[model samples]
Target: MSDDNGLPGAQTRRALLAGAGAVGAAVVLAACGGDEDPAGPGSAAPTAPDGSGEPGAADVVVRAADVPVGGGVILASKGVVVTQPTAGVFKGFSPICTHQRCPVSAVDGGTINCTCHNSRFSIEDGSVRSGPATQPLPAKEIVVDGDRISLA
Candidate 1:
């Protein structure tokens, strides 16, 4: 028998309904089988071998000789700042200021100064040396493997 559209009637309707049901079931099943905890709270966040979140630390390194004596800071990309408070001693911190998370531009004498709000932090220990910033800048671990300086 045919419906008003001049095609199969009940059979076509049944087939169409069955196909839609199957499709719906498949979609539901697929949704249930999603990625299992790609990054859980307990799981260790993926990081470079040096323990830094930045990748390719093994290849990227700064030499102590390049850094100026007394104290000098280099602002690396990705909010990284490498500082040498004294010759042969290097420290790393996030270039972002603790006051308002502004990028620290220069290291004068032994102070890492933030142009934003003039917040100043000691290059020696990343401690807050001036007002507008109560908390110290977050320090990044530094690994001195031979002459190469890698972030940890």
Candidate 2:
């Protein structure tokens, strides 16, 4: 009773529809991801190179006094973690973990920790301090203007 195509008309039609649905879903996923977090669902609003929210915008991340020497602060809105590795040096990196694109949970004990998979990255250079991630965190430049901090 089957046609020369080796399947009934309804079965062949159903198979084609299933394949099309899968392709459509993949396209939808690809369109949503552009840059910043390539494979992530998305990230916070774009953080400008100067860390300003927008043009003519000068965003002050935090007071210099707020960041502890040898420690850092997580500016969620800016999607950056600023670390003061030494007495007066500040470093910035994307908080998204390279392990699985999870937002880094915290910087503690001199490492950035991701709660999702227990991956760790050094606070000093964003190098992987633990496994499940081989690539270091992506660095972002910032400038310390006296007591103010902004993307550079």
Candidate 3:
């Protein structure tokens, strides 16, 4: 038995409707695709914008005083970790763990720890102190001018 389009029976009509619905769902998903969210600013870090409005130049991730000697702070919003391995020396590195890209949650006992996979990194230079991450966290360039720590 033929319907208006000559496709077989009620079963065929049901299949056609289901297929169309699936296609519509796929289109919706494609429209929303991207590495960043479209709803708002992708990062909360404050940045100094050029007149053209493209930001991230000379952004201050944290105050020099905020990072403690022999410890670090995870700035998840900026994907950087600021550490003060000594009284006056400051360092920065990518906070995302080398193993699975999970952000390191804490700087404790002279190591940065990724809660996701138990990867440990040295606070002094972002080197891996233990596995399951064999690679070290990559360095992030920053300039320390007096009391401020800004991305370079």
Candidate 4:
């Protein structure tokens, strides 16, 4: 007994429902597709287009004096890490970890630590300091003009 589009046997109601479900699932997955950076401006950080938290070309990342001499600050909204490895030297790197592209959560003990899988990178050059991540965080160009740190 063939069904409407008839081939061999009649389609069961359950089978029809399952086929419909599969199509729905495919549509849902397609809607979610992308390799877009999850840390882009608003993951765990606040964002604004009115020149607030979001990093703009002219936005000051942080006051130079605000970052510690041997530590760094994670600017999640800016998607960058500003590190003062030495008193007068500053470095900037993408906040995203090389391990799984998770954002690094802290800068401590001369390392940028990603809480995702405990991967650490150098605060000095963004080099990998530990494993699970063989690559280093990519350098992010930043300008430190006197007392302000901004993306370059």
Considering every candidate listed, which one attains the maximal lDDT? 4
Q: Write the per-residue lDDT of candidate 4 for residues 1-152, one digit (tens) a residue.
A: 43546644446765888899999999999889787756675565545433456455247878799899989999999889999999989999999998888989999999999999999999999999997999999999989877778888
Stretches off by above 4 angstroms in model 1 are: 1-58
lDDT of 3 at 92: 88
lDDT of 3 by residue, 1-152 (tens): 34555655867788899999999999999998996745567655443543223343446678788998999889988878999999989888998999998888999998999999999999888899999999999999988877678778
Candidate 3 at residue 46, lDDT? 42
lDDT of 2 by residue, 1-152 (tens): 55435744877788899999999999999888755565456656666555657642456676677788878888878889999888888889998999789898888888888899999888899999897988999997888888778777
Q: Candidate 2: where is the Cα deviation over 4 Å? A: 1-57
* Candidate-wise lDDT, in order: 0.76, 0.82, 0.84, 0.86
The runs of at least 3 residues in candidate 4 whose Cα sits more than 4 Å from the true structure, single-residue gaps closed, are 1-58
Better of 1 and 3 by TM-score: 3
Given candidate 1, what's the lDDT at residue 2? 44
Return the TM-score for candidate 2, rounded to 2 decimals: 0.61
Cα lDDT of model 1 overall? 0.76
> Per-residue lDDT for 54 in model 4?
45
